[model samples]
Each structure stands twice: as C-alpha cells, then as structure tokens.
Target: MSEPNRFLALFDQVVDQTIAFAELVDRAGYAAVPVDTPALFLGTRVDKIAIGALVRHLLLAEAHWFEQVRDVSPGGVIPFPSNAAALEGIPDGAPLLETYRRSYAERRSQLEALTEADLTKEIVFAGRRYTVIGFLWTVLGHHSFHLGQIDLLMRQQGIEPPEYMEWPEDQRVLG
Candidate 1:
C-alpha cells in the first residue's frame, strides 16, 4: 500500500477502535453515569470536571481540528464545561458515541480524499503552521492520550475496561 493510503487506513482503524471501546463502556453502564460524576482528571482531585463533559470535550476538540484542516472555521463549539448545565445539549451513552462517529464520518470525507500533495498543503492554527498530515498525526496522538484517560476512568470506577486491540496479521502495515 502507498504511504498516504496506509496513514488513512490507520486513522480509520483508530476511529473504529475508539467506537468499539466506547460501546464497551456503554454496555458496562459507565456511559449512563450522571453528568455530574467526576472525570478522571490530572492525578489531582481539585481540578476535576464532569465525566460526561470529558466526552464532550474530546468530541469538540476532534471537530475543531478537523474543521481547521478543512479551512472551515469551527462554530458552536462549547468551551470545556465544568458542570452539568454546561453539558446541556450533548447526549449521554450510545447517542453521544453515535454523534462522535457520525461527525467524523461527515467531516472527514474531504480529508480521506486528499492526495499526497494535498496532505502536504499547509494550514495554520493556534498560531503555528502545519501540514494536513501533521494535523492528522496530532489528532491520532491526541485521541490515543485521551483513550488512556478513559481506560483509567474505567479502572477507577471498579470496572475492567475492554481488552486492548491486537493488530490483525493481514492488516499489518509495518514490518
């Protein structure tokens, strides 16, 4: 496979795996937790936000970065919320995960269509310029970091998280 295609496939796999993991969380009943339940925050107790708000934060961040890459200004992204009222519009449980998945599928079609040249096209955000590929790499890494946080959230709540994904032999892209 070509390098750009491989990167796109990896991105899709990451999204798919996240959706699967979230399904596990939903089935385990954590996703139904009250909006006011504390999120697993920085190894400190004082700065914690609601667990549902953490999910919303991840969704909004993904949408914002993807929109920036598409040269579209993000509108209506609520700032990370500290309380339940701030999370008013976002859904909980399966509905929230479905929204996360659908937003990516809709917004990322343009990204998935990019040629290698397009991947190298520059965009500026947060006062720094970077290629589309750079932004994608950032998104993948950011999702991974938050995935671990979700895992910890599960563990802290006395639920064993879903098993980690094993790369399938046929899908292996790296030697």
Candidate 2:
C-alpha cells in the first residue's frame, strides 16, 4: 500500500481498538463499579481517585492529546481534571459515557481528516518532537493501560469483566 493508504489503515486499527474497548466497558455496567480500588495521587497516597473516575480519566486524556495536536499547549487544556475529586463533581455513568463516546468519536474524526503529510509532520511536545502517529501511539497505550486498571477494579468488586474481543470463529457463541 502507498503511504496515505498505509496511514489510513493504521488509523483504522486504532479506531477499531477504541471502539472495542468502549463496547466492553458499556457491557460491563458502571452501576457495578467497585466502591474502592487501589488508587494514588502523586507520591503520598490519599483517599482519592476511585473506580468511578477511571472512565472519565481515560476519556479526558484522549481529549487532552487531541487538543495538543491542534497546537494547543499541554497546559492549555483548561478544565482538564487529573484527579477523582474533580471528576466527582461531574455526572458519571450514562452522562459521562455519552461524553466519552463523543470524545473518542471526535478524536477519530480528527485523525481521519489528516493528510499523509500531516501525519508525517513533527509535533514538539514536552521539548520532544514526534510525528502525529507517535503522539497517537502514546494515547493508545495510555488508554489501554487504564482499561486494564478498570478490569482489575471490576474483578476486585467480584464483577466479571467482559472478555477480550476475539474472532467469532474462536469463540463458541452457543456453547
């Protein structure tokens, strides 16, 4: 495939993964969230950042990076909340889930509209230069990490998390 085609294909893969994760979380049910999962802020531990904050955190992180790509400074993401206390002020569950869905959709639209040249251009972030692809890779990894945390939290609450997305052929549907 040509360069443009290659980038589109890769971008599509990221979209697929994001959608899969969102579906898994939706099916898991937020009402069953763990009251307390291991959480920390900075070096000193505190009674902040609960399981309820995880989804919002992941969604906001996606928005933060997307804003940075628009030439906004990392610190320019005003109202970007980093802790559970701040998130607690926001409505969660269905309200937040809808917001989360919109966030990811907007990010995907932004990426899909990028030209191959744009993807290859360098973006300086935190004194380091990275291609558009490099920045997205970081976002993808960060989101995946948080997804794992959510899964662990669910297990701690004795709620079986949704299984990983797999080939329909690999999974028996009517077993």
lDDT values, one for every candidate: 0.60, 0.55
Residue-wise lDDT of candidate 2 within 1-175, one digit each (tens)? 5544444454444434434444444433544445535534422222334344556666666666675565544333223334444345556455666666677678767766766666666776556667766666666676667667666766665656556444123332311
The parts of candidate 1 lying over 4 Å away from their true place are 26-51, 72-88, 167-175
What is the overall TM-score of model 1 with all chains considered together? 0.69
The per-residue C-alpha lDDT of model 2 at residue 132 equals 69
Best by lDDT: 1
Write model 1 residue lDDT over 29-111, tens digit each, in one string: 54433334444343221234433444666676777666556653222222322333433565667878788788778767867
Candidate 2 least-lDDT 10 residues:
166-175
Which regions of candidate 2 are displaced past 4 Å?
Answer: 1-39, 42-49, 72-89, 167-175
TM-score of each: 0.69, 0.63
Could you tell me how far off, in angstroms, the CA of residue 62 lies in candidate 1 after the best superposition? 1.6
